[model samples]
Target: MAKMTHMKKQENQKSHFNHISHKEALVLTKIQQIKHQKSMDYWKQLVIAQQQSGFSVTEYCRQQDIKYNAFYYWLRKIREEALESLPQLPEKSTTNPQVAVLSATTVTAAVQTQSSSLKLFCGPVSLEVNEQTSNEMLMQTLRCIKEVFGIC
Candidate 1:
């Protein structure tokens, strides 16, 4: 019996596929090159920050000035790749003796901090304020941060 071999044909797929003008291709290639040159650690940091900070993807992207759809697309891509590459995580042990104490302490501290922050005009105001109050102070401050400091 003869062994069978499979051969795949290389079509001129680039021409057949959605083709961009050379100028546009050049621009795209340059952008992709620039993106590739960014450190892997930078992307890892972005993934971790987005995951751990408890922010919605769109909110995080908007706050970080990342393109929204691109962020979500990349996030999904990363997760899928990671799932393929990594071993499954070990199941969490339910019998950890100190978990309850640690969680209770953490929750108590969080509640205390939140209550402190919500105190009416009691916290340290960074700027000296006159009695004249404005309705738009929070909105204005947020705008200033976004525009001037490039913080959102």
Candidate 2:
């Protein structure tokens, strides 16, 4: 794109920015893209901060001076983008997906029943999830887990 002739560049820039000269449109688009990226980064940081702060969304929004619904909107938007960025799984796979929700008591019983080098104990319930889980299932499971843990 940088190597193109000025006149030729103008000739090819007729997408949605026809209201302005091609050069101006290109500049405007770049600026808008940068702004959009910054906005995403800002909101993502806020979401991470709230998570680490151990504050509920309502409380976090109040402390941050942002509307409650607006925070949720951005959270949903960012989470969807993250899910989209993950690589797609194969339609048919030979491997089995291992997913389990185990209570502390259950884990203890399992440990007592067998002597193994591997063990997992979560005070609250715990889930063992892997990439083989469907994205929808993973998100839903995670939302449920968050609600259970009250971390979100």
Candidate 3:
């Protein structure tokens, strides 16, 4: 009983949040608004830089003094909000075969692109291109390299 009473007293003595003055509250609100506006402006500028330069978000953020984790968090939140706000398209019925066929074609194309990329990256055959060479010149160069190296 004594230990319980002591614990209760200690718990009751723990500090709670103090009330802020009206002036302080006003200042805090203004500060919050300024922070939000600055964040929006930063996002706008960062996005424009990325689109213009074709740099990855991490690279852009490194160049622009933005935190990569914070940028990614904001990006995720933006995507989630946009997806949630978008109106859902009506489901196609099996009776309407054209819509289904088109969707299937799109899905197949996407899958093929994805799988081919995976194969290009991870499969046995290696592929690369020299940016300076034209297609006609590239074949000649490869043929010469093959002749010189002799498939060693």
TM-score of 2: 0.49
**TM-score-best of 1 and 2:** 2
Identify the superior model by lDDT, candidate 1 or candidate 2: 2
Residue-level lDDT for 26 in candidate 3: 90
TM-score of every model versus the real structure: 0.31, 0.49, 0.36
Model 3 alpha-carbon drift over 4 Å, by segment? 1-17, 62-65, 77-152
Whichever of 1 and 3 has more lDDT, that candidate is 3
Q: Rate the local accuracy (lDDT) of all candidates.
A: 0.55, 0.68, 0.56
For candidate 2, what is the lDDT?
0.68
lDDT of 1 by residue, 1-152 (tens): 66444432224454544577788878989998778535333555576677667898788988999988876666565545445543444688788755344588899987676555422332122333333335465445444333322334
Best by lDDT: 2
Q: Model 1 clash pairs?
A: none
| Best prediction by TM-score | 2
Q: Is candidate 1 or candidate 3 better by TM-score?
A: 3
lDDT of 3 by residue, 1-152 (tens): 24568777666655321356688779989999899656655554455456567788878888978889987776555445434544455687888576344588899987676555411221212445434336665455444333322221
